[model samples]
Target: MKKILLITILSLLFFSCENLDDGIKNSNSPNQFSQNFGQSVQRDFMGQVVDENNNPIESAIVKIGSNHVNTDSNGVFILYNVNVFEKFAYVSVEKMGYLLGSRSLVPTNGINKIKIMLIEKAPITTVNSGQTSEVNLPNGSKINFDGAFEDENGNSYSGSVSVFAYHLETSNSNISELMPGMLFAEAQDGSAKVLQTFGMLNVELAGASGEKLQIAEGHTAEISMKIDNTQLATASSTIPLWHFDEENGYWKEEGEATRQGDYYIGNVSHFSWWNVDAYQSMTTLNVTVVDGENNPIPNLGVTLTDQSGFISSTLTTNQNGNVSGLIPTNNSLTLEISGAFNYQEQIGSFNSNSSITIVISSASVNTFNFSGNVLDCDNNDFSNGYAVIAINNYVDYAPLVNGTFTSSYATYQDTFNYSVYGVNFGNNEFSTIVTGQADINVSNTVSINDLVVCLNSNTINLAGDFNLVVTRDDGNIYTFPNEIIQLVSPNNYKTTTTGSWAAGTIAQDQGYNFSINNLNGIIVPNQGLCQGYYSNNIYGENYNGTSSNGLIINNNEFYIQYTITFNTGPRIYTCHYIRN
Candidate 1:
């Protein structure tokens, strides 16, 4: 029994040991299997990010192959845990306000250390200030701007301010919204710094400035300052500066005023007041014409009248609905703009010393007194027809449709009758015609002294059982019967029968003679043939006496088709008659 007890104990201990061994084996087997199946891929990359000033940028993003990483506070970034022998990877560094940088690196056996330096991004400088100061600089020279910052009440700010300078390229005009120049410097201090190495200079003021600026030559060097935020008004003044003339490669400052080949340099600030006497003076005038929507009117005719009869000129508005011109001196001026649709005349006077814009709206008063009617060939009114009435000349072959003749004169009538009011009578040609209709009158050919009425009629005639025979001076007789006739005549005529004739008979056999006569007389022979007869028998007595069947009629009994050859003269006629 003791031996059995020992064996039982031994057996229990062996089972316990086996359970422990199984647990250990299971854990160890899993670890060994994972070691054989899984693998760790490490990807390493390094790069740097900087600003346009070549200063290191922090918190930049770095991308290696498919892995992404960000730089610490020092603008350094790296990627790890990448497969070394898998494939070649790329390193990219990205930062705001800096150009993106990228590089390729092939992983070796161990940790791959790649150093990438990112380039500074190009600066983006746009002109957001309304106050533009253009400075002309000498070639191969530079300009440094130094100015003090002040508040709206002329108090200086105590904090460090940012300063920016722009070199105005050829594309930097006052009308442009973009500043196409190299950024000279962006300094955080209040000291002066050079902005551009060449071309014109434009300074942007961001911190402070008073309503007015005081600039002196000796007290301060050539400097540009930021105007006060309260004084940051959109209103601007233009001061024209004279150019420095160079002759034979030498600077010539004398007799610069009368030179023909002169150019402009820049604007005159408060510092330029010392040389204000020698500054070439110019007067600027701003002109603007607008429609009812206040949109700029393009291709407007502008006239400036002084003592001279009239100085006529034309100008088109810019995108800002304004036009500018420079005058030599100040004088009383009257501005007139013609050829504006739905716009009135805008006239005013001002001292032409500074840039000014003249805004012209539609005229308040209607001008010109005009009246006319549009009539058809039958002298009937055209009910819904439009007429285009031009004063001087006809521009188009067709009448103007939906077009305004003047500010107050418009034609929308099928039958037009207008009394043009307040018209300044000059050498004017009045041409009025209906749209899509034949021109009834050509006033361009008529003289101002003779406002004669031109009457034109187009006649369509049906053969009225009468044969017409035309006897020409050459003794050639042309006959027409049972045919439609088209004739143009000044005096419209109706068909009338003169002699009695029988039915279904040739017109020449019928006792009827027709004649056509003009003012000159005997244009066409009085000859016609009737096809039917009409008789009014009284008391059943047939008064069928042949009333001279052979008739010699004069040039008055018959109406003939005719066309006018010329104006102010007798109409030439070509007659057609019927003969059997």
Candidate 2:
């Protein structure tokens, strides 16, 4: 039956737009209609429309993009021929006595089931004169409208009146239906009681239609109402008088009501819904800060700011991890809680009258010492200098005046090392070599183990044929011949070779190979060293399998030491080459 109804509606709709310029192409037959839209692969989008209470809402309009469908008695709707590959469809719903709802639906790849909930509109309550009516508000409170009144020569009398009260179902900048701490109170008769009651009066006596009263220009009428014992008991005390501003849809503060024993008396100058509330009452809130394990965290800074943009307060938790404050009733506030030293900060919103507990997590701290010493090539302290350790891109430096320096910093817990380079400014006489290793692990404990580095230099003057003799730790000796060792001058600053030569030697005694005046310089091995192995340079760059070496000249002797570890133990290899 629904299918027939849909086809009929579609046919009628198509015919109605036949003459329009942008009308869809008209189909003369049912087969043509099917061919126009039924050729594509079809998928069914099934869903049910439910009210806020999960009850099915029948006759609601469900629209998917340009397509429209109406829910059946069960509030179930199915859209046929929906393209499954479309990925997303914009769905909107409309129903009488309910707020319009919308949701974006993503096809479940295989499943097309969806559930959409709609909020029902609050019933519009209207009360007539000289009678009392009880209507339940959407927020679970019940309001009783008692008798109406008219002032006849300053005497109160029962009169005809029209009163309208509606709970604004939709929220806007002007009015919000949900107020914090607003709830149904128990009455003396075991029924749900209202926070307040209202009694409206006729503003005028003449020129008014039935049940309606007209007020004179430049003048207004007042509503006289009584407070029942149930309301007073629910409030637990006296409350201020207020009127619901029908024009503005908000509660406005009027003068305080005079509590005459059991009844409170107040005056209203205009016609609208009147209410008695304790908005001015002080509401207390208790805040507690705790860790993830429920342990109390004391001395944490907590701040509360009313979302209404008026009030703010700051306090610190006591030893019990609790802090209490009083706020104006029915307010929502944003709470921010923070602490020092390894505690994470948190911020959220809460009702001002409610007690809440906030959780703070503990953060792990990492501490390590970055220490090393700056020295000369002769193993002497290079006083007054600085050294830096570069871990990835971050750099940390410490001053080394007496050849030793130490500094510490904290980082997150991680397993990593640093690449360090040290330079000593010997009063601008020379600079320490930029040399360091990349294997210092500082993940768990304090580290201050130092690596010795040579920084001093000497001048070289002799370059000639040199015989190299190697000695192992076991006193085994090996010799290599036909090796060319070059000693370059200071003016030839660019050298790319390794092996020891002569330093600080005058050309008059040693003969001129490279000129030098007591300045230590580097050695260059112009040919390959031992088959195909080239020495590693100062920079940490690898070329094939060739490794470079560093040399320091001291005590008029050449000291070259290298370690080769094979499986179990390290074999120290030393080489001594002489030019005479």
Candidate 3:
């Protein structure tokens, strides 16, 4: 960093506080007044003081009309016994190393809490060019240049230099004036006009739009300063150039200028204007959009906006997924890109003369539309229940009226398609065909019109206990409460406590449907002399492979044929065995 000379141009503007509110009692001095408003009444006011950076300024002096106080370590201050009728009052804040802040406060319902932000004082600069120069001035003030002059020959000119500091106005003043009640005196005859002997030259505002020559927001204000000397300047040295910040009401040192022949070039961030003692150009910006696979993704919308309030433009990517246009180089730029429904939107920031590529992830969107019917075991329309379809954990429901239902976006898929409808519970009002397979793909419209969902009306009561007898191969018999066996339920029409095959008590209302308990204690008469007691036709093959196989003795309609292989050959033994 280079140490350059900086001068404060303080133009103080004063506001008229002459007319005081009638409700408020006036004192000769602003700092002198009664602690009480009237009638022993008091109104409290609280506030905080901070710098432009939002850091709290502790011990700062705060004045609310006649009452004054200093902020604590937390930068908080309070004023008590304020006149309630006074709608507004002047508040002045002062702290070292910071510019003074003053404003008017309007109390609501006799109370108010406020936050005051104070701007830091611009650093005073000293100039040393073989000869050193320093301006002796009072504190809390800035210097303003009245005018600049030069001889026709462009040689060093000498004249009287007059500087003035203006006071900020209270009544007619506005926030735009950084410091309130501050101004400079008018330059007089024989005043020191020419501070130093320097040739006059031109400082042009590059990239300025109109006759007003204002720099656009988000665009840099290029300042080109030409020195009368024919010698070319280099970046190794420095030229002092400052940009005025309207918000902070101060002048700040701009970046170093690049030397080109007799001209020095510098860039200003914004148009609030610049006082340069610098020149300018920028180029086209190109943005590319690609997928996570690094392949070009075309037809994406890209917009570039200047952060400094410059004009913004939008363009669409070409087949190559690239968009290019002339963009501002005077300031920072922001890029916004958007693409297809599945891809995510992106925003990026870049500097001047920047061209970059953005990568986005391609997302897969899957949605399923279902048009199906809900039916009972007899293939009859089931109208009492609602229709529900779940795909990949995303479920959509519709009312089942007249056995028909239609749902949309009711399914999602990844890798493969799997969906179900109206078949959530094992104990349902109608038999359900939950294992039906439907072949479908993602992002495609598939009609599930043939999806015939069945309902099962079986419900088991686990509170009651039931008994079952099992005969093992060793000829040992074991009796147990149905709860002791796992996964032993018989059919889709029967409900079990376990989702898999399990032995459990059946509800009284449901047990009668299967009538498995009737087989208990029934004796079988031996019909032949071959061996063990056997009945000709008893056990049926209907419940053979179901959970009810071990418990149900017979279905009463078909006889069961048991095939036993003795390792030598397949021996088929058919018998109807009843429990005694």
**Tens-place lDDT digits, model 3, residues 520-567:** 212112122112222122222223444332233332221122322332
Best by lDDT: 2
Report lDDT per candidate: 0.29, 0.40, 0.36
Candidate 2: tens digits of C-alpha lDDT, residues 1-580 = 0000000001001001111122112344423322332123344455656654344455579876457787643355656566422322435678864555444322332224445666544334444545665544333333444444444343344444433333321111111111211111222222222232221111112212433243323443333334432244333344555543332112344555555554444544544344444433444566777656665655455655454432222344544566654444555555666444344333334334456787655543334456666666666775444455555444443446467765544344344555554443222222322433332252333333333344334323223334556676788876644223332211222211212322211111121121222343222323212221222111211112323332425323243444433334545555564542
* Cα lDDT of model 1 by residue, 36-135, tens digit: 2123456433333433322234446766545676553223344446543222233556664333444432343333433344443332232212233233
Identify the leading candidate in terms of TM-score. 2
* Comparing 1 and 2 on lDDT, the stronger one: 2
TM-scores of all candidate predictions against the true structure: 0.18, 0.22, 0.21
Clashes of 2: 13
Rank candidates by TM-score, best first.
2, 3, 1
Q: Give lDDT: candidate 1, residue 459.
A: 19
Model 3 lDDT at residue 398: 49
Per-residue error for 129 in candidate 3, Å, reads 99
Write down the TM-score for model 1. Answer: 0.18
